[model samples]
Target chain A: MKKTINIPLGSQHIALLEPVRFSFTCENETIVGVEADVGYVHRGVELACTTTFKFKQVGYVVARVCGLCAIIHSTCYTLAAEELMGQEVPRRASYLRLIANELDRIHSHMLCLAHTAENAGFEALFMRTMKDRELVMEAQEAMTGNRVQFDYVSIGGVNRDITTDIEALIRQRLGLLKEKVGEIKELFENNWSLSLKYKGVGIITAENAYRNSALGPLARASGIDFDVRNESAYLPYGELGFASVTMSEGDIHARNMVRLLEVFESIRLIESALDGLPEGEIAAKVRGTPEGESYMRVEAPRGECFYYLKASKGQYLDRVRIKTPTFGSVPAMIEALKGANYADAPAIIASFDPCLSCTAR
Target chain B: MFKALLNALKNLFSAPATLNYPFVSSPKHQGARGLILFDEPKCVWCLKCEEVCPPGAIRFTQDRESYAYTYHYNPYLCIYCAECVRACPDKAQALSQCSELSRPTSDPFMNDAWFALEKEAEDSKEAVKELKKAKKTEETPQP
Candidate 1:
């Protein structure tokens, strides 16, 4: 029998930090079709950047577009400006940027995992995870002098230098974090109820994930094995040897595992970066005319973030366009949610770790 | 299923792995970026901090009579980059430790107040001597 069921999951739910609406058509308890409606918190960042803000000032504006991935936004935007000016950033500055970026990934992924635990009614685990997550924030604060929105990256290169003390502090913290993460992972792995709830839920086929162009852990969990860190090899990532994690199941459990495993990889990258960091100036003096358009991409917490920028002789930017990972993953999310139980909708949504602020920006 | 339940129950007897946050504070490292502070008495009117601030959160105006600088820091736009602290040549010592800055509905331009510049003890003495000398010279009469 063909019947229509409207399950409007809205602009405000426990599962989401930002506002987004999803309408699902379900046959009995299983969802048959899904529709997404975003733009609840659109501040028109691109428009604002082009209209009133200058090139140097746009970094601050772009950083506010998404608080979780603020550093990535600023880094990518600054790199775009650098490319337009045909400038080469100092090697030390690039490493510092990489350190900040990796720390951000750790914090962001920990938050996502904590949220998942919260949604699953594991309050104890949630609180513990958040507390442990603060270590990364502290590391970031030590390095860039701010927990969020470091403003460490500038057009020419990074704005600050990492001292020997700061490098040693990062190394010590990573050592402690390794032990903490192992404990947390053991706790999660031992919980049978968590396993049952997350495993085999919201399954996305490898073929569909590829066809819809999903990126980051979402694609990798479905055995895609694609990462901008490997393909694009930006910043100091090329020197660091790390493997992209993947699982064939493509379920909620697999995605969670991929994120969990990637956390360690990020830690290793940070450690390796600190060990072999080159000595150089933190920033270069940039002066010239930017006449053409250029594109830059970075692997953000959610997925791949692509930035398109156009500059003229004037100080004000001519055009600024950003393609966030949320936009790319929304379609795949809808596809994954189809045929899942209605109760599983929130779990499926949270699995992608959607960042609506990035999307609306 | 019964065996799975038994195993799950066995896991409950293990020690809880979560941190007790309200009762316990998170670990702090030496270089943690806690907060920003301003020293009212040590400022010069250079406005270098204002020039180097990426977010334009710091503002200062000159007091011509005193030849001193007045500074303001708006926490709303302050990304806490500490560039201002580094750029101050006088070591104005304006920046201090602070942690609880983020607030609800922060206004970027709200920070506007005057901080008095600190005068060195020797400079104060020199000023007094100069004033007395000027008075004596005036009393002595000029040709």
Candidate 2:
């Protein structure tokens, strides 16, 4: 006898903030096929950017698309506008932007790790990780003056400069943060329950990850050595000696490990940028209309966030297109979900760190 | 089995590393962006705060006669970005370190009742001062 089993998970799962529905066809305990339906939280941000607002104001609106990866959205949009205007931002502004971006990455990856731990029933680890994550929030407040939607980046350059006091404060905090991250890593590595829950679950081979064009730690965890920071060489990342960390496991455990290691790498990048801190104007004068379309990409906490901007003579943009990382990885997520156990569905789903807001936007 | 039980027992007595958040408050830095607060008297009606706000949370209108300012804040829309606080020309008109940003209503838009009341009180005080001045002038002979 042939029997069909259906397990449907809605967009309102406790583990997810945004809505994404998943239907898993399973036989006994093993998933046979998986289907996903998104577009629940689409706010038409890109559509609004082109019609309603000027090109300069769109940066803030784009940043609001996702609260976690706001910096990447703003940075990518700024880079596109800069390309269109044919303006090179000053060295100081670029370095300051990189500092804010790295701080954002630290906070975002830490929150994901905390959420993963919470979902895995590791409350102690979740609380401990979040406690350590507070340092980045404090550092962000010190630098950009806000923890979330940092309105520090502008069209021509950054709105603020990093003073001697702020630089010294960041260095001191980073030193302490490095020590704490090490302790947390040790704890995560030693926890047997965590290992059992994540290891060998949601397996995505390096070859498959590349074939699907996975970005950020998802691809890197599968041993794909591709990071836009290393490839594109944007801003301070060009000057810093940051290497993409990769692993071959390609499972949930490997992805989590990759994120943890990337946090340390982010600290190193921030330190190097601060060491070679240049003294110059943070912003440059920008004028004239952007004539043609320009494409810019940045490595967000999740993956590659790309923006395509077209501007005419008027202040309003002709068209603004955003391709977020989550959108790119959704196909790979459905592939990973196929043939997996029904119990491991949430783990597999969260393994990609699916930001439905970014995807829908 | 015996060895595993022994190891578990040994781990159970180790010191608890987590901090009690509610019972013990962590040391907050002076530059922390906490909740926003407004002082009515020091405001100069410049409206610079409204101009620089990234989110359109702050609304200000100038009074007709008194020259005092009326400011409205929709706490629901406020992301606590601190742009308004940073843009405040008067240093006293910025956000405070108190971040208890909760409200009873389901609507996030009506969360700024405290700020609304503060602005109203200032307006009422200005109105009363004008009334007292008019009363004094009426008691005296017309010049």
Candidate 3:
């Protein structure tokens, strides 16, 4: 009776990172078509940013869009609002923002890597990766004064200044993380079982990635060479000699490798930013309200997190439009799923590292 | 596989990575964001903290007869961002963030009470404004 069977992969599944549903049309364990639903977790964050909250309070509001990249959201929005208000952020504040952002990237990348390993049925590696991830979490908590929702960045400048004690702690933790990541990298690379699940399981051609407009490591893994960090000067990444990591494989393994490599780069950036940290007032005296329309892009751990802010000289913004990376990468995700084996669906989807909450918001 | 065996042996000897919660306490670092502590005596009743708090965790209810302000804070509603502390006047310094905030009361009454208190705060302020306006009219007489 039924020729092609349809299998659904979740709004709730054991392997998914967030609440997202994907239906795969399979012909004998090989996927022929894919459909995704990413709007299940929408919280109307964009509408709230404009209507409910004032311009000053919107920074904290947008930070709740996604827990993993909370600071990144605030940083992007703060930068946009600052541009509108003509606010000059202090040098030390810029460097501190950079450090916090890099730390966030490291921790977020680790989380994705850990989940990818877990979804591939490597629970031991997943646990070990999460254990090492605590180093960055501790460093972040000590530096930013909060763990997940770090309301560190405000409009004019950052809320808190980085101290010498916190600096040393960050350096120490990153050092330990560097060694630990090297070991994880080796395991991801050399382990025969991980290779079987990852290496060529879910391949996206370079053309396909570019055509579908894949973002972040998903695009970079396919050799597209697109990274928002290198493309923008939102933070002090240029001064820190930031480099984007890329791979040619375009498969599950390549994505994991890209994340692993980026973690190392993120660590280096944080340490560098710390060493060259300047001294100045942490926050500037904010004088005026934002008057003009301005857009900002920050390299969130997932991908390019963009904010289009329009304010007409008022406490409440006229409009706030957010373009999250997961939303951009969904088309590419469905494309990748079209030819993948049904068994490797979890691994492939995990490698994409979709944040449905961020997407839906 | 050899390295895996070695790691297993080493892990067996080493301490567990996670803390034993409730038995041994978790580590609290310096400058960790915690509770918002208010000093009633030092407070100038300027209501800066109430105005700047993002979550409306802090509120002040005004008594009509005495025209005195009573501070009401629900720790659960607070995001602990310290925006209120930053907004507070340096001279007043009435609001400060403590290093740690454990779970406060989780009862629904606290949450429901906050809604009632918020309404009362607005109503009381409105009542006082009307009273002042009425007094001014009386003082001016029929103009």
Candidate number with greatest TM-score: 3
lDDT of each: 0.80, 0.79, 0.90
For candidate 2, give the DockQ: 0.17
Backbone clashes for every candidate come to 5, 1, 1
TM-scores for chain A, candidates in order? 0.97, 0.97, 0.99
Model 2 stretches astray by more than 4 angstroms? B1-54, B57-143
Candidate 1 chain B: 10-residue stretch with minimal lDDT: B113-122
Provide the global lDDT of candidate 3 against the true structure: 0.90
Q: Model 3 segments beyond 4 Å from truth?
A: B105-109
Q: Taking the tens digit of each residue's C-alpha lDDT, what string does model 1 give over A1-361?
A: 5587788898897766669999999888999989998888899999988887778778877998998999999999988888898988888889889989999999999888888777776776787788888789878888877778787787788866788888887888888888877767766666787887788899999999999888888999999988888888668687887678888999988888888888999999999988888998988877885669999999998889999999887878899999999899888888899999998787778888999989988
lDDT by residue (A2-117, candidate 3, tens digit) is: 89999998989987878999999999989999999999988999998888788999999999999999999999999999999999988989998898898999999999999999
lDDT by residue for model 1 (B1-143), tens: 45435645765896664559889865555544544567767766566677666666666544434644456566666666666776667556656545543342434343333122123323543665677788799999788
Give candidate 2's error at residue B137 in angstroms. Answer: 42
CAPRI category for model 3: medium
**TM-score (2 decimals) of chain A in model 1:** 0.97
Docking class of 2: incorrect
Q: How close is candidate 3 to the true structure, as a TM-score?
A: 0.98
